[model samples]
Target chain A: MKHAAPTRTLLALYTAMVAFVLIAPTVVVIPLSFTDKASLTFPPSGWSTRWYENFFNDPAWTAAFGNSLTVALIVTVVATAAGTAAAVGVSKWSRKRMAKAAQMFLLAPIVVPSIILAIGVYAIFLRLQLLGTLPGFVLAHSVLAVPFVLVSVSAALAGFDDRLTTAAASLGADRWTTFRRVMLPLILPGVVSGALFAFVTSFDEVVLSIFIKSPYLETLPVKMYASVTRDTDPTIAAAATMIMLLTTVIIAVGLLSMRRKKIA
Target chain B: MPDKTPGAGTRIDVKNVTKRYAKSTAVDDVSLSIEPGEFITLLGPSGSGKTTTLNLIAGFTELTHGSIEIDGQRVDHVPAHKRGLGVVFQHYALFPHMTVAENIAFPLQQRKTPKAAQAALVASVLQTVGLAGYQDRFPKELSGGQQQRVAFARAMVFNPRALLMDEPLGALDKNLREKLQLEIKRIHQDVGRTFVFVTHDQEEALILSDRIAIFNNGRIEQVGTSADLYERPASLFVARFMGESTVFKAQVSSNGSDWHMDFHGSTLHGPVTSTVPGKGALVLRPEQLRVAESRADAPAGSAAVPVQVIQNIYLGSGHKYELRLPDGSTGIVRTPLTERTSLRPGDSAYVHWPAHQGVLLEDNDLVSTT
Candidate 1:
């Protein structure tokens, strides 16, 4: 094997360090989940399944996990449906002056800061008496999720001919049927990816969840934050480990299913 | 597809339809009735609105004015899918996610045909398009021609009212294009469905269409059978567009029944086909021009328009030479190229043609520089 150059060696060293800086926290949580000692730190004296035991014994951690899954699933379903419709509507705009103006408005969610959107959503939720409710939290998460759906669905629409939809309609497919059989199956990859992004966004949401969530309505991330703030607990790390594993499994399933579908 | 097109008889009346793209009129007011079971080709160059007219009929693009009726029912307000028409795009938009079988079954499935009947219909169409066993293959696995066959099978699956094809064979290679063109014609005869095909290729339109609507600037310049359009083109644009024609200016001195063309310091005689008697151009096809050793061997009253050969290209059976007249009028002439040839570059010769061979066209500024 060829030896790396001196400058390249330095670059490789820095790259490895940067990766460690980003990945170290997540990696630390994994080991801390199994730490014999009840603390969040690396290089413990001895390793045991003590924290893993804490994870299973505590009902708070399990309920948080359940809440996070419920909210994320609802958000993913709602956002994907709404975003696909909005994208399909926008895609039909004729290449004209008015169409451009309308398109920019639909894509505004992506251009504006998420924190700004979160603040606005919280304000609206407070007025509607929806704050601290799971539905409100799901809706708030969907704002962020919808943008991903838009991006993916738009990408799929770009590759499709508008005539195909019309052709479907001409073939005696009603509007809903045409969307189901022709447009949906044709753009399935984009729609599936959109749902994936929606799930991921809602599942990992922290900032917005903290603003809108009540003590009882707290998601896994919110509960973990509260537990960490109250005092040191290695159970938080175990809970984090479980959440990451769950997310990974879901993403892997969606991707593998998509691949197999394409092959078929 | 057969659903909209009755097997016995039908006529598609496109009554005064016009489509506009914002301020630009891509397709001006155009109206023509396609006879039942006839294959009509909309022939024009790019931006001539031939494809736009097809889209209007297919309901892909809504018309700004007028209406379209198939066998006498107004279809202008009908959405594309509800129009019950089959369309084949130029790029062959086969659903990439579906297998050839699934693609063919799509329209039938949309119609909710029984699954068993759908399988048989798809199978028959596959065999008809010569892809019986390739049904399981995705569009990507097939070549351009094979994918085109799949597209054809999908379009005909539901047997809609008519087949609207937008330059369907454009993406295929030369040999495949001709073969597919013949296949499409054979299918047309077998199914006896009306087809409104769009294309810019003149040869394709000539070979395929029973009648061709020659479109120009979003309007129908001429609509006739291939023979009628080729032999009796009314407009100079139609004459120049349909096929190659050599044109030279002629001054008309009278409006008599036997109007004469005073051209190139020679008087060429032809009937006065024009009622608006004035200065015109005498257009003659290259095949109409002939070369003789001398005037002694020429026919009587043959207008010997003197020309000098500037360049000669020997093309096996014949020689094509760019002939330059003294008045700077230039045209290409094709004649038999043999060892007995008497013409060469810089050689002076007289150009002669039959009187009826000359067509009088208005001296417009639209002479194509291309």
Candidate 2:
């Protein structure tokens, strides 16, 4: 039962303050979601579940939520599979400088400004006549999501002993069997976390969603933006709070699994 | 633990195997003919291609040129998995998520052995490695030495053709390393399987190998028994690598029946193995050379040179004296503690060796001082 030193206590307090500042916007929306009033105001005169009800009752809000969920699920699957494969290939095959340069090029979507990427994607989708389609949004979101998955899986691969695969092969396991038995299990945590990151990135994406949204097809973030601009709807607060909750749960799951891995 | 043979031994013939990277050669045209149940150690300094040769033999690395045959069947083109060989790496490389039994059962599972047979084999191997009750423990739960035993058990449980170990005990502490060295030797003897061990430790090579292949600059310098290498080295490199020696750079002068070299105005005679020589190094082992206070005390016909003792290091059983010869070159002489008086630093002494013990290697600088 040793007390913490003053410097350690101060450091903890400073970190808490910074974290509160960062999460203040999301925390504000959570309280507003339960306000009795129709306006988005803090410390409401009375508290009620009206905004949550408003979010559930409106067809537009429900449709937007449904669209976001479907798109994010599709993006997570597509991006995780493709990105994990790419990360493995980069780690195994790209041992030379030119191939490594090619790997960096493939990860460019994560580094480029999203507004610029939105412009480019919008132009391409316009000519392809995929502007308002689900596939178009899924494709754009997957491109943005691929880099997060790639980075995560690649870091995991770096820690993974390629010698394990060699050892497997020497033990009479074929290439496919070695990959299935040795490589996949060791890197599954990375793949899962990458999938979660991909889902969150796609769910919260606003710039690309705005660029490609049709009048009939609005994702949750796009719908929230419209509500914030067109009306001070408290239901938008409920949507934001729900979106934040989803991401927090996903990230917490990732962190907890990582901690368990360290302990194990 | 006892002499229980589990698998048939393999005769590996590496015929002129060569491996090249983009910028350099990892292994040159090296060939070795290993018997069915012989333990051969590939001994060299790091980057001398000992491990590369082992990898090539294990079918882990593809040969740039040449071929290999196992049991008289050409296997140069076979993939590592199909070769049915066992390889133990420097690091244990144990699968952390697997239990000890599962790790040992991996090869049996791969070969589609029945579940009951797999369990029996895993249990037997666990006992063989002296980890009988530790089957349920994961690799992460074990100590470094325990993990190493698990790795060794996993590799040998399959009972493949030959076991290739690449510095397997390099990461362990001294005591554990010595203990495992004996374990590995006992296991090799009990199983009667061909073992190709790669290690940079000369003492380990001497202790374990029936024959040691000395590698230098991607080529096998010499291959012989420890006594053969110690008593008669083929090259200056082998002589220096096998054990400690003081080298004398001199010109050989022969008179039909006798050979001699003039060192610091004293003409010393020795038997000549090589007649055609320009400049050669006369290599004398520390035990072969004796240090005496007076020149008259040196043996008759022995090569004698005056040396100034620089440092005297007492190594419990003996004293090692670092000396500077009159010509500015350095040398070391070891004297048994019971046989001689301890010489102090800066004392003048005569270093002499028997006439027939000096081996002349032609102009090869074996040791790089830098």
Candidate 3:
């Protein structure tokens, strides 16, 4: 499988080009966030942490950050529990065609256009008087995040041996006990990765958040969108940098847990 | 080990239990009454209802008809977890996440046994399976044989009344399988619990089971001690399944004294055993047949068939002759080295056996199709 020297060099160069394309935006934002000038200008003449201070000092920005965290956390919990249960149920379904249909239905939110989903949710929330409410945000974000959880959890369950469940039952474990003692612990890596995915999905969501947001209850992404139109402050870049850092850490943690499970 | 009195095992009665799927019957009206403290093996090939019957007793599969009773109480409606039966699977379904001690202690913990007592029981069961000092090792850390020993320890740790094993030694090499077979037999003797085992390997069944039930096509062909099945098989299927046999399709008739079998073009005589005989199969075990130089050299009053020696195999302890019969079927004959005749390959010979030893069974398509 060893490549020729020229081919190896070409492959390394191609990989580096792809990596640069993916990382170029994050590199620009990180440096732009530390610019001394109020305006976002990458490769700045002077460097400072003024935008970072501004991000922490302004109540609007801080409130939006807090709101995003709250919504993402709630969405992670709700979506992970619901999605994990759905995955387990689908896996245990005797009729495979029905199970596949159910799975495709659960995954429909991911495939359907976000704007279409946002408009539908907004209409439902307005009638229920839940528009711009925390519950409304949570419900909408959970809908977007659940499919991520389902995909990860299903991947984990795919590797699980059904005979272990049978073995647990034969060892005097009831259904719930078997789940708690054997199935849960075995599939915990998948659940953890799914939770991480749910958090990132909710945090990074913008199109749905924009449609549903009230001025008083804006998420960080909504605030950043609004800020981009009204001003050119580097503070938006700071927020973007932090979001990148948070998601990168979460994804890295998810991958590490998955790798550990593989090694075990 | 303390010299404790053997615990009285539970009796399991499978009363005409049948399990039918949408298109086929997995287990046809099969009934077996297992005595307390008995080591009974359900022996058959794959797809033959033996494993289904084991699952029925384990309460894993619901019976479509009839009922199962354990200790005289009907348990057909009970779930597997509540049936209190230990099952050892063919692949050794030990929990990879748990240590040896933790795996063995799982059932004890389910029963809410005291922590100290659970540890003692795990240790004792591990010792019983000969894995005493490997408490903290995970299943994947052990070899297949060692993992199966751990599985056995886990299944028996809770002292279930009866243990069900479905080819527990099937995943091991032949040497390890034989070793574990002896270990399981000794464990059964020490614990005195009823054992219901399932295996396609007839030799393993013969070595370990006090009684063996032969299954074919979702039915129990015969249930008997190994000797009973070997010496007196009830059907052609049972006779062929139990051991290596040379079968001759024959026409059976009685002469008011002895039964005669017209095999191919030769007449072979035996005692009258079955009265309703028309077409029959004469089955002769390898050890029962001897290769002689000629018809006159065959033992007196023995039935003989003319055959050509195709190959002579030296088996260290005995000599085996591959024979080509007149009907284009192959026959085998095994003789002790002390009784080895000066027979060579390509030599014409007479394969002879005592008339009483040749079992004449009813011939039917049931034996040929499967």
Candidate by candidate, in order, the iRMS in Å equals: 2.0, 0.8, 0.6
Q: What share of the true interface contacts does each candidate keep?
A: 0.74, 0.95, 0.74
Residue ranges of candidate 1 with Cα displaced over 4 Å: A1-11, A37-42, A46-48, A95-119, A161-163, A252-264, B1-9, B310-322, B332-341, B367-370
In candidate 3, which residue pairs clash? Answer: none
Give the 10-residue window scoring lowest on summed lDDT in candidate 2 chain A. Answer: A94-103
Runs in model 2 lying further than 4 Å from the true structure: A1-21, A35-51, A93-100, A215-217, A226-233, B1-7, B255-258, B270-275, B287-354, B366-370
| Candidate with the greatest DockQ versus the true structure | 3
lDDT of 2 by residue, B238-351 (tens): 988998988777677787666777766767667655663666677788888888887898877777888898988889998887889766878888988875755789999889
- Scored against the true structure, residue B216 in model 3 reaches a CA lDDT of 94
DockQ scores of the candidates: 0.59, 0.70, 0.74
Worst 10 residues of 2 chain B by lDDT: B1-10
Please rank every candidate by lDDT, starting with the best: 3, 2, 1
Q: Write the per-residue lDDT of candidate 1 for residues B244-291, one digit (tens) a residue.
A: 777767667655777676675688767765674466767777778876
The residue-by-residue lDDT of candidate 3 on B1-370, one tens digit each, is 2223575788999999889999999999999999988999999999999999999999888999999999999999999999999999998988878899999999999999999998888888777778879999989889999999988888888878799999999889999999999999988898788999999999999999999999999999999999999988888889988988888877788886788877767788777866637887888899998988999999888888899999999999999899999887889889999887888989999998887777888887555423
User: Judged by TM-score, which candidate is best?
Assistant: 3
lDDT of 2 by residue, A1-264 (tens): 555799789988999999999988769888888888889778877899988888899999999999999999999999999999989888888357865886788789988999999999999999999897899999999999998899899989989989888888888889888878889898988988999999999999999999999988989999999999999888988889899888999899888988798776
Candidate 3 CAPRI level: medium
